[model samples]
Target: MTAISLPSAMEFIWLEADLLDSHDYAAWLALWTATGHYIIPTERDAEDYAAVLNVVYDDQEMREARVKRLQSGLSMSASPAARTVRTVSRFRAMDGAAGVFVVRCAQHIVEYKYDRTRMLAADVLFWLVPAASGISLQRKVVTLINGDDALHGIGYLL
Candidate 1:
């Protein structure tokens, strides 16, 4: 198992958020492994992934397609490019078996564009491994604080 420090793990998470906020899709995509998944479930306490409806469940292919759309300048939602500021806190890391690390953090993001500001909050979990380029995400799960409520035009990464 590759030994990775907790501080290093936190740094990696911070950098990921920064990249997303900066709309650096290429860099953000590079932080994930080929088989990584991004999940946002509709149920706040949902455990069975296959049973409940999901707000977003993006695999590698889906992620790539989304990035492609974002880069192509064809996504109307991103035409004005909502500028975002993300605050990640309460970051903690745990060692998983087989050299994997589980990172948990709370995130609050404020987005402004289209003449309106929106705030989103969530608890995020990341399964990561120490890879050649520092850390690679194996899975990312985000449970919105108000997952059961209505959300509008969530076309960008959170």
Candidate 2:
């Protein structure tokens, strides 16, 4: 049985970040398990995400729809998606349920569009399950540093 090392987990995270930064949504989507959820909570300390209002809480179907919308030319916010560069670091890993790994990290993103640049920082957590190929994301939660504040133009994947 192959074990998940910190370095390997971090590598996967970096790959995911790269995919998002490049707007390679299709490849990014392939990183998840069929039941995976992508979440961005409205509250920084939110525990039960399902009970609280969230900025994004997408399952497989919703994720697919979101990707389509971003790729389509219709949605105003997504029409010209903001260009983004993301840095992810400060990784910590621990075993969760049997055959599951939980990883936590810090992520900072710089987005530029319309000649303006904005920064976004967040604490990110991931639940990973080993797959035949390598590892698959079971859940991803991103809690923004200023989740409660008024924010705009986050049309691209973070």
**Top TM-score prediction, candidate number:** 2
- Residue-level lDDT of model 1, residues 47-90, one tens digit each, is 77657899888998999998888777888887767889999989
Model 1 off-target regions past 4 Å? Answer: none
lDDT of 2 by residue, 1-158 (tens): 47777888899999999998888999998999999999999888767888889999999999999999999889988878888899999999865787778999999999999999999999999998888778899999998998889888589988
Where is the poorest 10-residue window by lDDT in model 2?
1-10
State, as a TM-score between 0 and 1, how close model 2 is to the true structure: 0.95
lDDT of each: 0.86, 0.90
- Best candidate, lDDT-wise? 2
